[model samples]
Target: MTSDPDTLWRRCAHLGRVLLPLVDQEPGRKADRHENLRTWGIDTVVGERLMEIFAALAAHAVVIDSSVPTAQFDALPVRTVAEAATSKRDFELLAGLPDSFADVRDEQAVQLFRLSAYEGGQASRRLFQLSREVRHSLIVLAEHPLLPCPTCADVLRRATEANLPK
Candidate 1:
């Protein structure tokens, strides 16, 4: 059965909701409560988690609804979602940060919602990578002729709770 753009978008949001908590794990007994993720490549746990989320989205995109062609979606060029990108102001409100939205956006607010696997590059490189994935997927959803279905907007609602400061 072919699913429409709206349904596909909802599925992506659901996938994001499922993987959101993994991005923010509780500390181990000895580890600091607020630990930083190392810059280790996809071999590490952090990297693996990010890849897992992407993989989940890919699998769901093709199988959840037949409207999206696997090859086409996979080939979408990832890039920043400038106009449709999640606003920095929303990030600040959700994270309850004292700093200005611009400060957080400049620092890496995008990375909070989407995890990146790329290794070292220029500053804020990972943010750019995450934005690429987001933008690419959004394009797929917007361009594809999707079918209508019940949505999982609740997943997005729940994700707001996990929003934390960088």
Candidate 2:
């Protein structure tokens, strides 16, 4: 059975939504936050992989909310605080960030690049492992697919079409 990239992407999106209740719970409130993955029967490595996939999806959401241009998805440039403070930087600021997030700034920059590509149709192992987990999620959805929200589907479709093979 041949699987296309779009199918995999849609599956990842669905799994992300399914895992949201688990991942979105406030870490402070959930005593067994760590164990939720285990209790839910997700293995350690698979759980970690799901987290990574969620991160990529969250990153894409951030990029879209910021109104990042589709053309810029391929070459997302990073900007420093100093650069951002100065009016010279043309990069868009990702909101809701803490002032003390400087340490993870570089990591955030790399994430921006990866998420942008994923949102734009390009998938990568370094950014988000496009492995069996992603495939399995899609297969599950394929068995019983749901209609995607129009806006979300449109964005994902545009991104996939823009990034996928011609």
Candidate 3:
């Protein structure tokens, strides 16, 4: 679809910021407690946000790309974390976490820290992959002629009119 590059960039500035900071830098402070907290925040929260953004990207792409019928788009499978999880459990016992530096050294605290860090890394990687996919889909859409079908055009039109992030 033909789009004004300037307008598109403006519309996507928020998501642009996200893609900007995702440069492949050295993972910082490998053992710092605060670093664990940061990773955890990114994994549990930023990860979820990225998934939403990715879905929006896919929706927009599917709406514009005529090669794939819109009917098939709904049936396309999207992988989620739950699908990757091994099992589900309801825990009756929840452990209280450490509050200070010294407490953080305890076995439970260390394990929790490691677990959070691991999960965060996984999420960050997933986010990176999703970003690449969304960007690629948008690029393909931009290079192609706008969908000529009225239904597809209307779907695309409503999406753009909503002023949702690209």
Candidate 3 lands at a TM-score of 0.24
lDDT of 3 by residue, 4-23 (tens): 32232222223322321221
TM-score of 2: 0.24
Per-residue lDDT over 1-166 for candidate 2, one digit per residue giving the tens place of the 0 to 100 score: 1123233233323334333233223344223434554555555554544443443344333334445543333232211111222221112322322223222533454355335445643333322232233332333322322333223333244335445321
TM-score of each: 0.28, 0.24, 0.24
Q: What's every prediction's RMSD, in angstroms?
A: 14.1, 16.5, 18.5
Q: Between candidates 1 and 3, which one is better according to lDDT?
A: 1
Please, what are the lDDT tens digits per residue for candidate 1 over residues 68-166? 433233322212122223232222212322233233322242253332323334423543443344333334333323313212232233345556212
Lowest-sum lDDT 10-residue window in model 1: 29-38
Error of 3 at 80 (Å): 27
Worst 10 residues of 3 by lDDT: 85-94
Candidate 2 residue spans exceeding 4 A from truth:
1-31, 69-166
Q: Write down the lDDT that model 1 would get.
A: 0.33
Q: What do the candidate models score in CA lDDT, each in turn?
A: 0.33, 0.35, 0.33
